[model samples]
Target: MTRSTPTKPQANPGAKPRVIHPWPLRLTHWLNAVAVVMMIGSGWQIYDASPIFGFTFPPLITIGGWLGAAIAWHLAMMWLLVVNGLIYFLWSATTGHFRKIFPLSPRAFWHDLTAALTFNLKHEPGVYNAVQKLLYFGVLCAGVVIVLSGLAIWKPVQLWFLTDALGGFVIARYVHFFAMAAIAGFLFIHLLLVAMVPKVLPPMITGGRIEP
Candidate 1:
């Protein structure tokens, strides 16, 4: 008599959904990264030309060789940033991306903040922890402020209302500078966390595998 082989178990189709970073989110994220780098570099060059603050960024670190070149690059990247931002916002709104960062609670934030400071925070793939949500929200607000301040600086005469609301060109410049600082700070911490948690990098690049 011939012996029969046992069947292997199949995956459950109704199991919990997997975490994915979705293509649209990934695309917008990378484009934003490129735009932010170019904008910041060129902006630094422009700042060096007529700095509001005492110090200036190193020439080597800045984009464009001169003020005029920097202005050109900055203007070009501005459009990319604006358009891409709009697309990201629209997509987020339509696809319920905002849900991930909503319902922020001070209690949760405090708890997570403590956990993070103590290095006890655990990262869940595809889910934004309280601290993460706050950071993301903060950056989004900074992005809007930066763009508006940039516009006020770029077209003070035409956008006189905006410039006036921001307390004129000088004040607008300050606002713009601080906004850039906020973004730079966020980027620094963001990169540091990525370095510490290298595994998280792959999911952002490749829509991560689902956990049961």
Candidate 2:
């Protein structure tokens, strides 16, 4: 009788997951996630006081029971978010991570855009594409806008200049709302992209690449 041949395990094609996110990045990232979630919930509750839409958001999705509680929660989360974001940005700048994240050349952006549109998006090792650069930078800028607008709304009398530049208190409030919406949208898309490339997320948590 002929001896049966044993089957070999299939090899992983992509590069082994590595420590892409350093300790600082991972910590700040998770902290940011937590803060943002808290902010969203508390924000909804606060919005209930003067909802822009026809109806108020469901209580189930909101953080606090009343306006006062909501404001407290919102303020608390805001501080956490601000602190974590500052740390992240500072670390990235010091580590020269900005070069990988911020697209400076228009040619590179065009190439990346073409790749994305053609479903040929390339995931470089430890590098972000043009789309990612733009989106991330946009989110950061939006956060700044939200913070400024929130301050204006929260203390219109004290921060009169901000409110005035934003076309007064009501307009500032709307800007804050819109900025929050943009962040929410980005969060959704970010998760979707992660789902599409499951390998990318593990490094964020474990801080090491998974061996193929």
Candidate 3:
């Protein structure tokens, strides 16, 4: 004779409540996103003039003209990114959200690192691991470098002091390019991680609950 099997309890037949992202965080995130995209697109048009690779494409004529439009858009977006980033940073600090993201202890660091690595290997853990904290810190530092270097290059005459501080206009331009590349690299890795763990996207996007 066949025996009856036990059944598990089921969730209520209703849609989960829709949560919203914090206004400031959401605004800053989307603004930064738009700025980054514009910078990269316009930047490519500018870069084509120099042709880093063997291939060369026609110049961009969208915003104004080729390099002129690129420079204008890049500079404008630069200020937007700076203002948004500053607001986010100050808000996090004053609101104590900084502590949640920043690693406070060695034990916590190691634990987070292990958890993150394990999760990447398909052994999911609770929340963001240590590697995430380090990456976040790196992004913040890169943002600072980008802004300072950009100022030196954008206004070498007006910001002569910054140019000198950063070892001259040429050096500042190089630093700015490298910093932008670093930020782009971070974005690529971030997107890859999000694709790998789709559940992770909802919290930042919709302020929805993150499963434990």
Candidate 4:
């Protein structure tokens, strides 16, 4: 008689659970959010001191009372953003998270983009899509530009080379401002996307179901 082959156990159809963000990433994420908020508020106040493009943001939403206070707040939040950003990047790199956020090839990215645009994008529970990876990588680069430009303008004489490379003090200042704007825009888009996929937020908050 012929022996029958054993089949693997099947998962429950009702089971739709997972573990996404880990403790370290979640911690850094929240910290980074607070830091960014602080930076934006103070930055607006500081900008009021020298109204860029002949316009100034209203005081109602601005953080600091004056230029001096804004400078202090901005500097304080800068350190927090920089330190936590560094830690998050380092941890993600070491833990293989970087690979998950970066597409393996241009062809793969093109395929993903076409799928997304056509509303045929496949959603993997905890995997980053090509568009998501591109956005994430772009944001990372924006962060680096902001930090470098901020430093260049903060001490033009001390960071002379950076200032010169960026086409002097005024250019560096403008770059910093635009970089902040890019990040702010990203925040709104990110939130909108998160709202569309409600399940993703819960995983980010509670670290998802570990054994589901």
Instruction: List RMSD in Å for every model shown.
Output: 5.1, 7.2, 6.4, 3.4
Index of the highest-lDDT prediction: 1
lDDT of 1: 0.92
What is the lDDT ranking, best to worst?
A: 1, 4, 2, 3
**lDDT of candidate 2 over 42-158, digit per residue (tens):** 999999999877888899999988999989999999999988889988998998877777655678778987987787987854578877787888889988999899999989999
- Per-residue lDDT of 1-212 in model 4, one digit per residue for the tens? 99999999888878876567889988998999999989999999998898657888999989989999999999999999999999999999899989888655788889988987687877766788877887788888889999999999899999999999999999888999999999998888788778766677887788876445
Q: Pick the candidate with the highest TM-score.
A: 1
Please report, as a residue range, the 10-residue window in candidate 4 with the lowest summed lDDT. 203-212
Evaluated at residue 107, the lDDT of candidate 3 is 77
Between the candidate structures 3 and 4, which one is better when assessed by lDDT? 4
TM-score of model 2 relative to the true fold? Answer: 0.84
Query: Model 3 reaches what TM-score against the true structure?
Result: 0.75
Candidate 3 wrong stretches, greater than 4 Å: 1-21, 50-65, 104-127, 210-212
> Candidates' lDDT values, in order?
0.92, 0.86, 0.73, 0.87
Stretches of candidate 1 above 4 Å error? Answer: 1-11, 14-19
C-alpha positional error of residue 151 in candidate 4 after TM-score superposition, expressed in Å: 0.7
Higher-TM-score candidate among 1 and 2? 1
Give the range where candidate 3 is weakest over 10 consecutive residues by summed lDDT.
Answer: 120-129
Question: Candidate 3 lDDT, tens digit per residue, 1-212?
Answer: 99999998776667565443466777788898888777766766766666545764454522325787778888888778888888999987886766756665677677766766676434233245556767778888998998898788778999999999999977786788788789989999889878878876666776664222
